[model samples]
Target chain A: MSLLNNIYNQLRISHKYVNRLFKERSCYISTSPIMRDLMEFFDDKKNWGATEVKTGRSWTKDDLRIKSNTDLHKLWYVLLKEKNMLYTMEHEHNDQVRLFPSPERLDKVLDSMENLEEVVRERNRAYYELETTEIGEQTHKTITGPFGLEIDYYETEHSIPKEVNAQWQKEQNTKCRPEDVKSFLLKYKEKEYLQNKKQQRRNFNHVIGLLNRFPKMDMEALKEQYPDVDIEKAKASRKYKPPLVFD
Target chain B: MRLTQILYTKIGEWSKKYANLPDRYIKRAMEQVYWRNPKGIQYRPNTVVKRKKFHFTLDRPWSAQFAETNSPGRLHPKVFVEPIKKWSFFRGDRVEVLVGKDKEKQGIVKYIVQERNWILVEGLNCKLTKLDRGGVKIYIQEEQPLLVTDQVALVDPSDLKSTGFEWRYTQSGEQVRVSLRTGRIIPVPASAEETRDYKAKGLYVEQPKDTSEKDLGEVTFEPTLKTFEMEIMDQMGIKEDRIPKKSYWY
Candidate 1:
């Protein structure tokens, strides 16, 4: 049996209800006045040919937090509507080859929605922590990627162990090659070395240039700009000769 | 009741005058048409008529000619509840964008295109739109405000001052630590000499040379929260339309 499948089975044995809750919430669709408003996220049939549509701002984190859960639910629809409107506008814009005005509005809404979800999750965590000892059960598993980097995989309680089950195991393990690894490591090191060397040379050159340009360089400003460089040694260098000759 | 009786009498008289036509049907059509297509009369164009008609001869070149500029202009019909003259919002009222990067960005609405649902805010970001076939279009819109609710700063009524005031970070205003949007506390200097030093060095770098150069621009001097109060107000466009004296800052 795969380790992840085993973990999922174990989790299912304990917190089966929470998993159900997540599934239910994810699938649940609201059809209310607020939801109707949020459905505005979709473009109208009449405006299908239009390349652009005007819209207001996304709901702020502060705005969402202050509202009661009921209000939040309603506002969710509002935001959802705005998202649909933006999507429709974006789709039309792309189709007609026009610039969608305030494209950042989409990102803002997405950010706001994400933050709202995070806040809800935080509340849910607190509630679960109060009732149950754990912050619910975080489905976490560590696995090496194709590049040999370790990543955590969240586990959920399921009927069967993933690794033991052929289908789940296929989903878990991804394909990787030894030659690709060697090449990746080589290129990664080379890139790292280049970046460091470039930064070092830039700093060294800047120090030399500063000393050359401003012979009586402000001690504080110069030191602040290049903290690692030995300012005294840079000043003493022949390259540090100022444009004005000393009388 | 008395007004209804008079209308019936008038209708009866009109029916006898034009006896051949159906009086009730004609009255109903007139009322329905009046109810449906009532448009406010505002601007009108005058037409001139020529007393004599002129004739022109056509050349028999045997060439077919087709009119190309026959595409109808596009328009979205919308009814305005109020007239433009009645709208109090003026061109000079400064609009300050209340969000990041463009926060406190102030501009005046140069022209209000009521029919088009557009306002030309001077100095705000404007874009020239190019159509697929040809020609360019211009559009102006307001910056969206930051979505926030609980992060609103609460001020104590007793501590209100003309120069300096107290602000709490949390919604409840019970917490001691305050978080500024700029991610730093308002600096308060110790003396007049320190104040001058702070202003000279404390000036935020408008544009840093590079990411590494940010640390170099950090000012050693600190100014009091009082000195920085006006800067916030000036940047926020509060001098024109003062923030409510009692309302909480969101």
Candidate 2:
């Protein structure tokens, strides 16, 4: 049924010359030995029992995107099987207390798997947008925290409502109360004011120090550094002069 | 505070970039702002809340999110077939024999001959075939074949490994033996120096920390697609596995 569906979908595609398309171009495999060999990417007899098996980097998104959807789906399973094989081999190698040759092959397979998934997802998203009103599955929502901070709440399915769900209620009810909020506001404002005052003093003293240290300072750069500070007025101050005489 | 400031600047730049974008970009930006939970901003009510129809039942059990306390029945039994990523060989229980008027030969299965349903044997007597430029398929006619005729038997390649198989990392000399049927490692693989380094870097390394509510709260900070996908998992009622926590990029 699924194979028929795939064929039907292929036939439904918009092409200028439909009759010219070859039957082989469609999704069908006549079960051949050489083709099976192509599917199995392991070492031949000579290479078997050998410690290490070398492999190349994974297929990137750009490479995958150029292929047809049917090919991509087939490739997904190939990559998936490859990853599982590598993992099993690596796992066995570890148990035997021997080195698993070409461990990076596993990493490459994993990378290819990731890239393939991304490509599939990109296609899925495009297809979903083209046909449906939604973007396949991802969702988001706003939720208010206990501290009255409004946070986006991602909607999730739950057997029980938020009011009845004991675990979720604990998190929701833990929010700060009005009394706690007022006290938090007071301290938060005080902290901010103190921070600004300290910063102002630091900037003021730094300008004076710059003037004292570099008497012939680059006035333009100084102005760029502390735009609010009056460099000329700061230079005129007694604190601006160097402590020791150059002579 | 510096980090927050930098994040704000980055977000501001992103918002500016999509200021004139069509509906899709605006929607994506809005979703990002919501999920990221940016500080010091009131939640906007301008967007529509898209509700999804989700069916979740506690009785069904979620395999992905919540760990199953018991082994799943044979219906969903985890098959520990050989993973195909690394170099692996299935030691066949029985060997197949190939015979003909020209020659007869046999060999051990170093690997699965998926295409021809044929196995490549170790010590087999056979006539080699050669193709010529004259469009004639020719076999190298040798008076003698390599091996004897008794070298044939149909073996279940799957059944040979009751003792299980071993995976060897050829580069690092690390070996792991796991049961092909059960997927359980009889002798767990030893951690290598590079594996230790990966653990230190927090890549897919298991944490030995005590599992608690505080530990569970750490879920909020995890930047994995699974974090969000867990919502779907919750809907599926699939119990999660208690595998060692390792860093996985979404």
Candidate 3:
């Protein structure tokens, strides 16, 4: 019993010692010889493996717009680094099967980045607009697709000229719709047309029924409601021959 | 209502007198004929004149066609762009913390938060956190804000005092930082020293070069925030719109 107890103590110490070794190595490797920029990606050493992390609000376009291009430029990097750091930490945590702290911090950084991009785009547009009397945003055009559907095609610069470039030519060759697509579109349109006709017929008959039952009904209002229905013809028809009594 | 119904029925019968017999049912017969024999054309019904369209969304909006003509794409963005041109302080530059417990304490500029306008100078401002490592508890110090850009100022290279700078044009049209008090031509930061094109922002080489070259290309100077402020109102004077829409954010 005493020997068994001694073995258990030895096993426990070894386990604790392994744990200490891991903790020591991680702490030393992560903490030692760090620079300022490294600080941007790393949470405070205390926040490492923390269950929660507190943060402030994301950057808004208006607030960002007020900042100098230089400041905005700087902020972009800080947020970017923070994002990479969070992504890495989260990935590591996920790998280790540990809970990642406040994921909203990542969201906050992303939101700020999106807003920053939007603001930068706005600035680019404004600068371009001022310099050259154009909105400077990428222009889009409506083009007829192979399926004969109108599609918006945004114009972009290509390094290879269309006529000379075999790849571009091959891609552009998708001008005519395939037979199956045409067939699919045809049947799809037929279905759509039938659905429309069904509704129209229903509306027409509904008008006749309405007129038959409501003989003293406001015909002008009824005609206004169902413009397609011929009220006088319905009245002359056999369906409208005998007015039904309202019980 | 009764009078209108009577009028409608009378008009309905009278309309047959005015029109040909076949015209009234022509549309209905056409729909039946088209339905019985499915053809190359679809949506043959009267109301279906225009074609429906499909808009294709690119699988990647930020790539393929999304790349700009001049640049490959937007900055990879994970890396912080060292503020060389726009912000006055550069990492490794000696600076004095203007605010907080570390006020007036001079230290080497370390990390900077460009957008939030925060800075962390080495050993200048420290926040204490109690941490537990395994079974051992220890105190950890986090170096963060002395607030940032406005919170600190570059220590004058001459006297090691805080100083402001203005841009001066060199003979070669390069812009250089002119220290306000001493009229010293403080070298343009290594980060800001590059030409305006692609090299404007990035990581600074760990060691700052000795104060040998300090001028910036005219193109490197970014448009100031104030240039956009009261944009319509310039040194030429404020031009009020004949009618202010008041539609813009201040």
Candidate 4:
């Protein structure tokens, strides 16, 4: 599907002429048969020094879901090769201190690859759910770490069972001071609280300034916009005091 | 997070490139093995002490992510099979072998050839070989000539005839296979236990029609396509035993 993307078309040509052209010129055209392999890695020769290269959006999960397994598997390898080529070119360009052409090409390929995996994962989950009563997503758990803090750890397959594994046991059994960890967590929470408090103050002060500048300010809208800000307090602030004026 | 994933993916590509390095970049890659996890703390690879070992990192590169639990079954690395796209049929399903030595033979689906478009029917076709070695007779049973996807069709449970299958949800929001020919709500063997209690109690509601959820665009693989290594595999006569590796354009 990526192969036919963005090729120049002659839609303006009459159907009869288009048919004749295809028949005479050979329907299949290998523009760069000589550099077929190189085409995988590099963009067109014309785009060697071009500023930008435009491409289509990434493959969506729904789009990939519709593809047969064989097709998805085939496209995966194609995309994988494209990614490798893109990486090689970008690495070379970086080494030579040149701009990697439209770096988002790399992004687009990666996005497609990701979406492909997501689609595959969805299929796997559905299949597993039907065949077995479980969604076959990679499972993880929040376990207490060495620091006495809960950390998300992925469970992996082990050659030796956990009951008999010595190496894993050593990693799991680490000495931790609960007091130290509690202090550390408290400090972390305090930092977060202080940052949030500062933001709230800033928003409140900004609201006061706005109300002062505009006497006919929509108080209800302002209250809705900044729920954290005490609108009544902002209105009572000296900056927001109504200016006395002779009529 | 997205940028990190892209960079990590590039590192994976670099790992692959290490195999055919220009001898100039191997040293650069050896100096640092880039690895990271989305949520975990970042750290440099400080455990390495060699250069040659750096190659084949793509196969088993150092992963900083919390290790995954061991997978129970695996399609061989050489054999990258697609995950089952739909639950149209299953192992216990009674399928008719449409083409083979036992053509038109109806039998229960013994096992599915994972990743490959084939299935083995129970006790249908078997190749038996008797070998006498070291004064001992060995009987080897092999199930060959698997039923290809095109050559076989699913047999409906009601009439024991081939039929197209559709998906429909039960009253309890359970997905079930519906036999198109009979309009019989194929008991979701997995989810709802096809219980008389649910049906007798008037709890089961059949969906009006099996709606086509989405356009699953068509995708096809050139079955004949083979790489240079596959040709070698073919020469070795292990080609049939091995899945063909797809070409990686470089």
Top candidate on DockQ is: 4
Candidate 3 Cα errors over 4 Å, as ranges: A1-40, A160-167, A176-181, A189-247, B1-250
**Candidate 3 residue pairs in clash (backbone atoms < 3 Å):** A75-B115, B119-B148, B188-B214
Ranking of all predicted structures according to TM-score, beginning with the best and ending with the worst: 4, 1, 3, 2
User: lDDT values of the candidates?
Assistant: 0.43, 0.45, 0.56, 0.55
Clashes of each: 22, 63, 3, 9
- Runs with alpha carbons beyond 4 Å of true place in candidate 2: A1-52, A142-152, A158-247, B1-250
Model 4 stretches with alpha carbons more than 4 Å out: A1-35, A214-225, A241-247, B1-250
- Candidate 1 lDDT over A1-247, as tens digits, reads 6999999998887688887787687556555434444445555555555443333234445544544444445556666766777788788788878766545457656766776776555555665666675675464767565565555555665555554567666765555688887787788779879977776665666678756655544466556545667877776777777688585
In candidate 2 the C-alpha lDDT for residue A207 amounts to: 76
Poorest lDDT segment (10 consecutive residues) of candidate 2 chain B: B51-60
Instruction: Rate residue A1 of model 3 by lDDT.
Output: 100
Residue A105 of model 3: what lDDT? 66
Fnat per model, in the order given? 0.00, 0.00, 0.00, 0.08
lDDT of 4 by residue, B1-250 (tens): 2222122122322222212222223233233433334443422123333222122211223321201211222122321112223435455567777776888888765444332435567777768989999999999886654534356677777888887677788899988878899987655333112232132224433322112334234543232334323433565576366655542111
- Please give each candidate's TM-score: 0.36, 0.30, 0.33, 0.42
lDDT of 2 by residue, B125-188 (tens): 3446686858877767322221111223433244433333445344467665445555544432
Ranking by lDDT: 3, 4, 2, 1
Q: Candidate 1 regions off by >4 Å? A: A1-58, A137-146, A150-158, A162-187, A210-247, B1-250
* Candidates 1 onward: DockQ, in order: 0.00, 0.01, 0.01, 0.03
Error of 3 at A84 (Å): 0.8
Best by lDDT: 3
lDDT of 3 by residue, B102-125 (tens): 888999755544433355688877
